[model samples]
Target: MKSMAPTRKLYQEIKDIVLLSDHRSSMAFEVSDEVLSTYVPVAVYWIFSGIYGLLGYLEGCRLHPKGAEEEENVASKLQVLRGVLLQQVVQIAVVTLMMKVVGDEGMAPQQPSFLVCACQFLIAMVVLDLWQYFGHRYMHVNKFLYKHIHSKHHALVVPYAWGSLYNHPLEGLLLDTIGGSLAFLLSPA
Candidate 1:
């Protein structure tokens, strides 16, 4: 039908973006798209975290007095790092499982135009923000959650980039790993 022309064209453009002519040769060393998609975010997280961690050590760049911040913090830097590492391990397992369970399903088949991509990005941000807000609020409002799990993160009274992910294992699993996996699954991009 005449009405289908624009829809078909849009679909075609998406298809062009998503599907490669050759999956095996898509990358330099035959790395699959899925593998890159799976691990790149994880690698970037640690890389950026390390950068931030290093930056936090620069006394001249600090926004707050180190003595004041240190006085407020109940947990040690080592403890925070350990929590972050443990959470990252849990996140990797959850993400890998989720990817295996729903590989390429409902994803846009091709690349979208600039306008489309912009819209998708905005929508994804809003969705993720709302998801995080509600999840965080729920944890905060519940006494049990705050006392047992979320308290671990709150121990880091001095907020720093390196301590950003220092949450209890259960809280990290529920609030971050699952929320992020669901967000990725729900994203059309």
Candidate 2:
């Protein structure tokens, strides 16, 4: 008979213990705690991204000299900064919301026979990409609406992550609302 590897033995022991344990309810809590621990750093990074983006936008606005071309360039840089921050914020918010709403013991789906989580996640990426592309294109095509609604965003042409959030209320709402709605609609139940 071949000897079992240490890791394999350890895993078997753990599996046996879990099978014998009567504290099944606590298992869910443990899993949830582990998940939270893993994601906490990601959340922190997202907050930092927002802060840095804002700082970059401010710096660009202050340092760039006064001239139409210079101002436009600075604005463009700020917008890029803002875009980075915005993307991080949106990603974090969606993950946080999903965990909060669907991560409870009772909410977890039945155990799958095969690993499908990766596939589902990929689908989510596709949906988000499509939605963002369409939303941006829509903003560019409507000049009147773009001037009033999206012009403030253009003010930071020099985009940084921080500049990402410095947009008109309507633009903000439109982007967030559309993003959130599409994410929710496309998510696998």
Candidate 3:
């Protein structure tokens, strides 16, 4: 009989290869100067939105202390802080991948107008959302896995932007990997 250990190892190796390939393909598509320019404004919006969102939440908590539990507020704030840091890491990875894939190539196409960009962004967002939902469900179903990896995320009952970042490093990695892979795979030919 074929050894189960060898089979498992082989499966893992294949999974890694698929993940790397997906990442490479996505990076290649994203590396154009045009893509960078497009991505930058979106990134900036994300940052400002986070800041404003947190500020609003805090103000609300202060104005309506009875509506917000102290412990939940503290946990939400901590989660948001952690999320910002994690977002930075993700941005770096995305930029690095873009640089690698776009090397020496001319800037991405400037024409085809806003419609194309909008469609692309919409598709990417849809794929990412689906991936996150399914991946989160997977993490929850496995008790041992959930306790060790995803428990940190659930620590905040009242979530904030930072609550997104309050997860185990492994869980963070898994979420990103899954989302990225799905996005790449679902990209138009």
Task: Summing lDDT over every window of 10 consecutive residues in candidate 1, give the lowest-scoring window.
Answer: 20-29
Each prediction's RMSD over C-alphas, in Å, is: 10.7, 9.2, 18.7
Task: Write model 1 residue lDDT over 109-170, tens digit each, in one string.
Answer: 68679998787777767777887889889889999989988888889877767677788898
Name the runs in model 3 displaced over 4 angstroms.
Answer: 1-70, 73-80, 102-104, 177-185
**Cα lDDT, all candidates:** 0.76, 0.60, 0.63
Residue range 1-189, candidate 3, lDDT tens digits = 667998886776666666755434322333545466536754775787578566755655333443454456545565556665675576557655754664445544445557776777788889988878888999999999888877777776655533445677677766764466456546542
Pairwise lDDT winner, candidates 1 and 2:
1
Residue 102 Cα positional deviation in candidate 2, in Å, after optimal superposition: 8.2
Residue pairs in clash, model 1: 14-110, 15-110, 17-111, 18-110
The candidate, 1 or 3, that scores higher on lDDT is 1
User: Model 3 Cα displacement at 181 (Å)?
Assistant: 6.3
Over the full model, what C-alpha lDDT does candidate 3 score relative to the true structure?
0.63
Candidate 1, residue 153: the lDDT equals 81
Among these predictions, the greatest lDDT belongs to 1
Task: List the candidates ranked by TM-score, beginning with the highest.
Answer: 1, 3, 2
Worst 10 residues of 3 by lDDT: 22-31
Q: Using TM-score as the measure, which candidate wins? A: 1
- Position 44, candidate 1: lDDT: 88
lDDT assessment of candidate 2: 0.60
1-189: candidate 2 lDDT, tens digit per residue: 767798786776677567755434323325454366436755665587667645644646444443433446545554455554565566566666665665667555565434465665667778777877787788889998788877776776544444545665556556754565466557674
Query: What's the distance in Å from true for residue 39, model 2?
Result: 9.2
